[model samples]
Target: MKKTVCAIIIAAFSVCVWLQNAGAEDIKIGSILRLSQGASDGLPARRGVEIAVKEINAKGGIGGRKVEVIFEDSKDTDQAAVAAFQKLVSMDGVKVVIGPMKSSEVLAVAPIAMREKIVVITPNGTSPKISEAGEYVYRGCSRIDKQAEALTQFAKDPMKATGVAILYSNEPYGKGCNDLFTKQFTALGIPVVAVESFMVGDRDFSAQITKLKQSTFDLLFIPGYLQETAPAIAQARKMGIVAESMGVYGDMAPKYIELAGKAAEGHINASEYDEDYATGKNKKFKDAYYSIVKADANEPNNIMFAALTYDAMGLVAEAIAAKGNSPDGIRSYLDSVKDFDGVTGKLSFDANGDVVKQGVYIFKVQDGKYVKVK
Candidate 1:
């Protein structure tokens, strides 16, 4: 009878311990990314978040709670993004989300995020409209206007181009860049000779290039994602259109050089993150990222997308650790924090939840590598 009593007491004590541990359960975070359709950019962005989460968990996690990320594929479409985001909010009960890499997708989910009072931070959606999306929406990348500013400056002093032509994607992001960069370039005294656009998945640029070739321009600015931009530039070069090629942040990837091949040489673009910044954290991140990428040959890796998303994940982890898992808690902490060191740069969110780093690095592709030009 005494032995039985002791056994019961031990069982009860074990249950109490288990209940306590369960109370301090893992903190869940949601991520909706373009895992399939736009995997080139999305895969690197996801890897950034994965690295941050892995490092955070290794260091005892957030506030003693193991951080868990629930990932959903956005499929790079508006309908898919909305569904993925709704699933995260409804089924996972996630208060914070990082994803929907495209501006259109982010815009599609913005209303729902605002209504649900969830925090949504996009690492690569650079539409200026996103600045006014909602209080619940934040962006880890510079707006299209900011990227245009850097590229325009480069156009004036370095390229010394008197006239430029634009070949942009027809989507929201591409259209925004075309408009903003044109304004910035014209403001800098560079006249826009021609403007042409192609659909998102357009593999043939023969028609677009024919029109662009007719325009007498010294510089060719293609401000779309690398997938289309690279091929377009390659076709333009093959057609003997020798206008110097330039682009925005999306063109900074090594894949751009690989896709454009010899045409990628002398290509100019702006980047938010400098891979050779010489910062200790950046060095560590690059080393870890290269190690991870080495293990998986199929996954695409790029500095701009990875660094931005890495900083986004770090920001989320900081906010969660400082405040809690609540949306308001994360926002409150994010608003007040400053000079948070990240692989991208010293990141601080402004009132609109836009990353406050004002500087953009000018990069040129030389010998199939991104060399910092300014």
Candidate 2:
């Protein structure tokens, strides 16, 4: 009889602990950023989420419940990403998770979000395969495949090149971009004249530049992170590969132009957010961003990193408000989100959970600065 009474007491204790945990203080949002180790651009993306969370919490949070944001670094590996994601979802018990920062990380953790019924909103992982990462996986930016189509259109319409050389960073995100570009280039009836590859963080690209210069290609399409891209373009310029160069979001940043100088001049790329292009809806947030970061309001691609993650967090908050405090409820709320205008732009999710993104304006590094090209 004593033992039975003890068992009942332990069960009651466990229930109380669970309830206490659930009713702690505020609604918690999770994020796993590959900030320090992966790509430098990922830092500003994470910062954008931070800035938004602070503002939201300061405004008494969603529905007067304060928001608590949980953060972990992805460390630029599959193992690190998976562990961070598991910690965010299982250990921290988050209702919504923001990111692991890259496509490889998204591929790892998105399955868990689906199984755990948590919404994972990746701000930068743009690989086309995200379309297949179950129902709960959502992203707030353009898909790399769709961007390839837009790029193809840009190549044919605005920046015409008789032939092209393709370069990528040999990651899932980079390879996916390369694949889409290859298909789109073929469909556009243009031959891919050459292809080159380099690992991220390599300082030299002379051999690849030599090959591209010798080839019949009149343009170069590089799909990789900005860290490698800056060096590659600088090296390509030194090696006299004068084709009109372009890259995707992995190469989106003012730092690229700052590093490459004259090499990256006239370079064009597609991005979801351009600070110069935000509607009146983003004025307050934009002002807040400049005040917090002490950055220029006119910087062209500043919106790419911080704004993307900010919108992801904002949408997560909106979903939480729509669903109260349940994971399944939040999932339904996210799916039911029809039109969410964010700091980036309107957030309209297709059935596959990617934002139907197109503020596909091309940008050029004019006067050693990133300037929007209409």
Candidate 3:
């Protein structure tokens, strides 16, 4: 009876100690992301954050505090993103927030984040609208204009396209990309024949295809992530209303190609990060990425947005550690951040919370794989 009582007393003491330790220092970072539950682009976005958090925790953590991520699904909706951001800041009390795979979602979250004085970083929300979203908004990756500008610089030859059509998902992200693509193509002397918008969730492209079939656009600028774009392409290809010169990118995923099948072969997808961009840092990431995810994957596995998203979280942690983990100090440190050497390459943000780096490589699948064309 005495021994059993002693054991009970020790167990009770252990529980109390564990509870004390658990409450000591748990730093919560809000992850306002579309994730897998939101959109097809989210699969890799989540993977990137998971990978970085694991690596960061293994490296002694942020200032000896245990880091915790609070994931709130925004579902790629404006209202949902605004609500998620409120919940993260007002309820969960995350010191720093990262992500929302889509730009439209990022825009909704940014104003709230600015009001709360929290640091909100995007892996890749390149819509020019995000630059002035708020004081707290930061982008680890480059924006659409740069990517589009890069595409226009390198792929104008392919546009051998005398006339092209601009089809976009009637959303901010799609509209943003098409506006630039149309301007660039027109600058190259390619006339834009058809500029149409489709509802975000619409799957049937028959209506759009019928219109295109009757037109003479040699190319098309179909933008937006795969959920809508993929099915639209499949339907267009099925109708033999294919563009002589066509491509899509900015929201590249394996499913885009997989869902598009034979039609996806010659389709050029632009990317912000080229696996072969530079040396050491670039190569190491690629080798590790392929070994684990396998080389046969169909998606844009090496998406810089995802890698940069992971890096964005780590940047917040590092900044927090440097500034005593206080929100204000971290925000100040963030402003001072210049040319941060990240997994994607050198990251330098401008006054409006935009990165200075420019260029998005146009990639194509040669044999069921994405190969950098330039």
Candidate 4:
């Protein structure tokens, strides 16, 4: 009897040790983002991933292994993004990566991701070219052309603008939006009168605005990051050019309103997440996000980017949970997933790896807040 009791105790000890070892093993993931340049979007997105990871681990992580995310800054450049991807995959040994939010970065890293068979999900890379990036490359947001489709129609029916002028950022995303929206507006029978360009990090838009003022149009469309677009609109207003202002998804931030001041009023843009979206998931996410970021003055508050990444992290976790941690497993799970209830909306992946969400949202700034138009 003494020998039997000792054997049972040893067996229990071994089981406990095994369980501890299993729990100690972490499932690593990688995140590449614009942590330095354009951190307003990148920082919030990082917070979103943090929130999702925290929540996932809090509930006894996937298959008893804690999720560990290795974050790398893309520096808002294609070469940096490629280096980050290689480092994350080779050194960190992460099977899946979520980031390099810019379309250019995503495109830059696509070939490597495909060659290595790494699963990559970009939260905000909206250029239509990304649809053909690779089988392993996935996006979490709607394409820019889709936003143009919705915004251009809204401009035609409600805004009732006859002619439109564009001031586009010369970067890939901004230039892509300019081309797509110009086509969309023209398709809707709204002639694009004057087109101008501005470089990223450009604070002074007086030259562009001065030239834009030379053109007569009932509507002014500026497609670029709010850092430049907001100030451009402000300068345009200051320089005495008053036409209904429109922008792309980059303008959907509180900072835009703050920067543009009263100039932001009546400015319309596209959005992914709606705060008024009544869902327990959304409520929990918003509560958690504000609770964390509201106290940190250095943290930029843009829930849209955060929400997209939150959903991206959550979906990746779910994929890992269901299909295992391999790239093929995650890709299969993503391809098969339908109607994932996310903070943004019901999300699913199409054949092209583009997210099929509810659709784009049109929002106008009113009283210092974004009000949904359609």
Candidate 5:
């Protein structure tokens, strides 16, 4: 009887260990981001995923299976992004991926993602082409056109700019923004007086600024990432161009202020996330974010990129919890559950996998901080 009891106890303990090990099997997700070339944006985005994973794991993970994210550095190139994405799917066996932050990179990897049936959620790829990428691809932020609508409306009513000049980065994102914003501004009865283009790494904007200064425009909109836009604005201002500097969501970082200095003052831009949004969810996210950021001295505490990726990760985790860890399961869950209460706001995905939020928040740089204007 004593031997039989010991045997039974051992058998039960083995079963418990097996069950615990099974529960610990992680549901892996992939993140492909511009970690080296565009680390400013990518780092904040990574932090957002880390925070969401930390929270989800702390709360018993997704359906008792611990969530794990495999990160791959895209280095801000199409080839690098495609390679990273392929590795994530083929080697890491991830059914879902978080990014390839730029539209060009997303466009490059989107075909492969469709072929592999891997669900990809781009947190910041705002190019209008992403709407047609496929059902498997989704975006966390609003479309470029939506941002243009908000920014243009603000230009008409508040800024009262009659003529606008565009200095855009000679790339897909910047060119797309220039085209869309120009159309929106025209619709709002504002004429685009001057247009100039600059390469990605071009630090000297003297030529563009000189030409733009010669033109008569009320507002100068630089449609590019902060890396270029901030410096361009600073150079333009230094060359005595007084057009109120404005930009797209890419300029919504504090780094822009740090780069542009006094030129950033009164600089207007559109943002998908409002840090001051009064909600329990927002407060919780802010607190958790600050706690993590405070610990990591190198982390940029910017809320825009973090908020976008946080919502994306939350959506993925929710889908996994509701359904299994299959791509189709995630896609189906996303389709059915339109309204997700995100830190950004109420997020609803349209048929094209585009998030439908209330509206973009119009912000202006005042005293080296983003102040909400609309």
Candidate 6:
């Protein structure tokens, strides 16, 4: 009887040890993204993180520990983003987080992330204000100012745009683009003849287009998410306001072309990733992304968001592997990182935690496809 009781106690101790070891084998990270509102961009961003995690785990993960990501829906609002960040940090105990993709959402959660000392990297936030958000906040994409500079230069030089008109979405991202691009255009000796704004879900752009038509402008620049931008461009073209249309990075998506149809022809925009970029790493990532997107017919196909988030996840993993899995450790690696090759480009971080990548690519829609013009 004594021997049996002793054996039972030893087995229970061993079981408890195994359970603890099993729990410790996984390194938990978190992601807050637009899973419901603005899902066209958000879904692809989520897939990018997932693909990177899968690849990392397949290669034995960071420091031989498996990686697990806890994802939360931001619902494309500031309040939802704050709640998501709180849940991820306080409840899930993740030291690193990879989203809240919009500039508004990123700014919303920046304070909490800084307070908690957690590493937060946004894959697509582009507001100039984000530069001052906090030391713990990082962005994987170029700022709107950078895009405006490159695009306005292209407009002045190649397009020969002497006068410009603006149609912008009345949101943080779109409004920021309008303000920056307007300044850039003015600096380049091109005058902005007219400016118009539309709400997020506004479909009938006839009124704005009519206002723009009254102005004698050689270039029409529309900056916003594709959901509104595409339809606005289609409506503008229908209203006969054809004067060399251009857009910011938000216009780079298959859905944009699909929505604009014939109106998308000759439309120009700045882009982060080039689908035809010749690299083994890019090819593998592109193939994996397409395979997954093709399997789900409902999935929105946009490689830009996915590519950015994939690189963000890759950088985070590299940081954890090089240093430890702490927020400070990750920030240290990012700050000193130079020429970290990503599918998007050779990436580094500036003093402001914004990605210093090879300059944005200029693409134009021709024959129902986006062809890199510069």
The models' CA-based lDDT, in order, is: 0.89, 0.79, 0.72, 0.93, 0.90, 0.92
Find the 10 residues in a row with the least total lDDT in model 4.
17-26
lDDT (10s digit) by residue, model 5, range 1-374: 99999999999999998997776788899998768888888888988898899989999998777899999999988999999999999898999999989988889999999999999999989888999999999999988888888888889997799899999999878888888888889988999999999999999999888888888998999998888999999998889988888898888888899999998999999999999889888898888888877897787757789888999999999998898899999999988876699999898889999998888899988888889988
User: Per-residue lDDT for 273-349 in model 3, tens only?
Assistant: 66666766556555655564665454445355466665677678778888866678777777777766667656666
TM-score of each: 0.92, 0.88, 0.83, 0.93, 0.92, 0.95
Candidate order by decreasing lDDT: 4, 6, 5, 1, 2, 3
lDDT of 2 by residue, 122-183 (tens): 89787778889988888888877667877887887777767889988887667777888999
Which ten contiguous residues of candidate 6 have the minimum total lDDT?
19-28
**Compared with the true structure, what per-residue lDDT tens digits does model 4 show for residues 208-291?**
889988888989999988999999999999999899999988899999999999999999999999998999999999999999
Candidate maximizing TM-score: 6
Q: Which ranges in model 1 have alpha carbons more than 4 Å from their true place?
A: 1-22
Predict model 3's lDDT versus the native. Answer: 0.72
Better of 1 and 2 by lDDT: 1
| Candidate 1 lDDT by residue in tens digits, 64-88 | 8889999889997899999999999
Q: In model 2, which runs have C-alpha deviations exceeding 4 angstroms?
A: 1-24, 295-302
The best candidate by lDDT is 4
Candidate 4 residue pairs in backbone clash: none
Worst 10 residues of 1 by lDDT: 299-308
For model 5, the stretches where C-alpha displacement exceeds 4 angstroms are 1-23
Provide the clashing-pair count of each candidate structure. Answer: 0, 0, 2, 0, 0, 0
Candidate 3 to truth, TM: 0.83
